[model samples]
Target: MSCQPQYKGQVYIWLKNKQTCLLCGETTDTPQPICTPCESELPWLGDQCGRCALPLPMADLLCGQCATRPPAYERVLAPWAYDFPIDSLITRFKHQAKWPLGRLLGQLLALSLQHHFDEGLERPDALVPVPLTTRRLRQRGFNQASLLARWLGTVLQIPCAENLLRRVQDTPAQQVLDARARRQNLRQAFAMMADAPVRNRHLALVDDVLTTGATAQALARLLLDAGAARVDVYCLARTPKPGEPA
Candidate 1:
C-alpha cells in the first residue's frame, strides 16, 4: 500500500511541510510566508541615515534634515523601503483589514529587529505603538501600529505598551499635508499616560511606515518631554523624500 500522507487542510500541510509565499504564492523554505527571492527583491532600505533611516548615498551618515534640524528620536531602524510590494502589502493590511499580511510583515520585521539586536542594537525598555485618535480607532476597528507592536513584542520579548500614549486630538489625515502642516496638525496631539512609568526609560515608538517622519518627531518629542531618556523610531518601511524614487 502507498504510504503518502493526506492532509486534511492547507494549514495542516503548511505546518507539516512547505509554507506558501504571501506575495508570489510560491513555496518557501524559510518559516516566513515570503520566499527568500521575494524578500531579497522587496526594496530593502540601503545606505540610510543612522538617525532617520532616510535613504542616502552612505550608511550611518546624517541626512541634511537631521544635520540641520534634528528630530527628537535618537535613531530609526527600518528594514524595507516604502516601495512596490511592501507598500501594497502595508496598504492592504492597514486599510483593507487584511490581517494575514500584517502578521507576515510583522514576522519579517521581528526577524530584522532580532538581527539588529544580535548585532548589538540597544533594546528599548518598552515598545510604544503610535496611538490612533478615538475617532480613527473607532472607524478602523483596530490600531495597526498596536497590532504590529504586539507581534514584535512577542517575538523580541519586549513589553508592549498600547496605552503608554494617548491621542488627544482628532487631526486630519496626514497624507495630504506638507511637512510644516503635518507638524502643526500634530501639535498637542499626543499625551502620556499619567500612570505609566516612563521617566528615564528608553522607549521605542512603533509604526507601520515612516513617511516625512513628522508624526514620529512629534511623538518622540512628547516622550522626551515626559522624561524618557531616549526615544527610537521603529517602522517596517521608510518612504523616500519627496521627488525621490521609492
Candidate 2:
C-alpha cells in the first residue's frame, strides 16, 4: 500500500535499520513489517461483538453497550487490543514523531480487515479520516488519523475524503478525561463541510486508535447527519475497558 513517507534524514535510516519490528527494536526483514516473533505478540482482536467490536462469546454479536445504546457507526473493526508493545508503539508514533510506524500500523489494519472478512466490512464508497483541528494540525505538522486513512484507502482501493469532515472546534484530549467527560467535551466538536460531496456514501471512518468510542461516535453522528448512508470505523487498536474480557 502506498503512503505519504514521513521520516527523513538519519531518523529514516535508523527506521530502515530497525526493520525487525516497529514495536520491539529487533532485526530481520519479515514479510510483514514485524518479525515473526513480534508478530505472534501482537494482541490481535478476535471473536468480537459485531456492533461494538468488543470481545464476546461465539453466540452473541452485540455487547451490553450495544444492546443498551447502539453506536451511530454500524460496526467497528480493529486489528489489535490497545496493550503492551502496540500501546508503546502507538505512543511513539503519536508523541515522539516516530512516523515510519504509520506504515506498519496501516499494514496491520489492512491485514485485520482481510482476515475478518466475515465481519462484513467490504470496500466502502469512501474513507474518511477523523479530522484534526487546524490548530492541532499546525502544532503536530500532521494528523496521525489522516495518515492511516490515506494508506488504508490505498489498500482498500477506495478514495479518501480528507476534507469532508472538519474539526470546527478544538476540544480537550480524550485521554485526559472519563468517558462522560469525553463525550461532553466533544459535543459539537465536528462540523461537516456545507457542500460536502458525501451524500448517500458508505464511509469507513479511519483513526489511529479507539479509546472510549466517544470520538468515533461523534464523528459517525456527524457523517450520518451529512447524508452518509453508513459509517463503519476502522481503527488500529481498540482500548479494551478495564474488566473486559481478552
Candidate 3:
C-alpha cells in the first residue's frame, strides 16, 4: 500500500508539471509553462537596485531613492521586469481570476527564490501576503497575493502567515497614484493581527507586482516595529521607473 501511494504521488507530480505553454499554446512537457523560447523573450530584470529590485543602468548599485531614503524592508527580490506579457499575465491572473496563470507565475517565483536560498540567501521564518481590504476582497473573491504566498510557501517549505496583517483602511487603489501620493494614501492603511507573535522572526512579503513600493514600505515598517528580526519583499515582477524604457 505504501509503495502504491508513492507511485501515485510521483505520477501526480509528473502530470501536474507537464503543460502546454500558457502564452503561445505550444506543447511543453516541463515543470513550468511559457516554454523556453517564450520564457527567454520575457522581460527578465537586468541590473537592479540592491534594495528595491528596480531596474537600474548598472549592477551593484542602489537607485537614488533608496540611497536618499532607505526603505524599511531589507530588500526586494524579483525575477522579471514588469513589461509586456508579464503585465498581461498578472492582469489576467489577478483581475480575471485565472488560477492556472497565477499558479505558473507562483511556481516560477518559487524556483527563483529557491535558487537564491541555495546560494545562501537567508531564509525567512514566514511568508506574509500584502493583505487586501475587506471590500476589495469581496469584489475580487480571492487574494492574489495570498495565493502566491501559499504557493511559494508550499514549494519552498516555508510557513505562510496569510493573516498576519489586515487592511484597516480601504484606501483608493494605488495603481493610479504617483510614488509620493501612494505613500500618503497607504499611511495607517494596514495593521498587524492581534498577538501575531512577530517578535524576532524574519518575514517576507509576497505580492504579484511591485511598483512604487509604498505598500511594501508600510508593511515592512509594521513588522519591524513589532520586533521582526528582518523583513524582505518578493514579487513576480518589478516595474521600471516611470517613463523609462524597459
Candidate 4:
C-alpha cells in the first residue's frame, strides 16, 4: 500500500516499502534519504593525497605541502570534495539551522566510514568533535561538528566525547584569512580537558569541512601533546587548494 501527500500543490508519494530521496523528492527503495542516482552524483573524493585527502592527479601519493611540512594528524578520511550541492547542503545545515540536512549528511558519512573500516581502515578509539567557543556556541545555538560526531558515534558504536577537546579562545573565523594567518590565529586556541583520558588511544576529530586544515592541525597537535597515540581527521568534504581545479 502507498500513501500520497500533497504539499504546496505538489504531490509526494509515500510508499510503505520505500523511502524518499531528499535531493529530488522522489521515492526510492534505499534506506537513506538520498536515492542511488543522487548519491552517485555527489562529488566523491578520488585520486587524492594519502595524508590530507587533497584532490590530486594521481592516487596514493603525498601532496607537496604534506611532504614539506607534515600536519600533526596522521591522515585524513574525507569522502567528498567541496563542490556543487555539497557546499550548498553544508551551508544550509550549518548557517541556516537545517537539522534534517545535517542528519542526512551525517548518515551518509557514517555509511562511507563503515566501508572504509571494512576495507582495512583502523577504527578510532573515540570520536571528538572540534569544539566551538562558548560565544560561537551561543550565537549558533549548536555546534555542527559536535552534532556530526554524535550522529556518527551512534551509527558506528563509538564513544562521542564532547569534552575531550576544548576551544579556550574564541579565535577569529578562518574563512576570511590565508592559510598562514589561519594557523597563527588558531595557535594555542585549543586545549584538552584536564580529566579526559586520551593517552595511547587513537582518536578521530570530526568536522564538517577541511579547508586548508588549519583547525584540524591545531586540534591534532593539542591531542598529541596530551598523549594521544594517533589522531586522524574525518571530515565530510575536502576543499581544493585555491585556483586548483576541483
Model 2 lDDT per residue over 111-225, tens place: 7776666565466888889888899999988889888888877876679998798998888888889889999999989888878887898988998888789999999998898
What is the per-residue lDDT of model 4 for residues 1-246, given as tens digits with 9 covering 90 to 100? 558554577456664457788789998668888889999999999999999999999987999999999999999988899998999999999999999999999999999999989999999999999999999999999999999999999999999989888899998899999999999999989888889999999999999999999999998988898899999999999999998877
Question: Local error of candidate 2 at 238, Å?
Answer: 0.7
Residue pairs in clash, model 1? none
Candidate 2: segments with Cα more than 4 A from true spot = 1-19, 24-29, 57-59, 117-120, 243-246
* Model 1: per-residue Cα lDDT over 1-246, one tens digit each: 879788676554445677889889999879888889998899999999888999998766999999999999999999999999999999999999999999999998999999999999999999999999888999999999999999999999999988789999999999899888998999988888888788999999999999999999999998898899999988999989989997
RMSD of 2: 6.6
TM-score of 3: 0.93
In candidate 4 the C-alpha lDDT for residue 109 amounts to 94
The sequence of per-residue lDDT tens digits that candidate 3 reaches over residues 111-177 is: 8999999999999999999999889999999999999999999999999998789999999889999
Which residue pairs does candidate 3 place in steric collision? none
* TM-score to native of every candidate shown: 0.93, 0.86, 0.93, 0.92
- Each candidate's lDDT (Cα)? 0.92, 0.82, 0.93, 0.93
Candidate ranking under lDDT, highest first, comes to 3, 4, 1, 2
Cα RMSD (Å) between model 1 and the true structure? 4.7
Between candidates 1 and 2, the one scoring higher on TM-score is 1
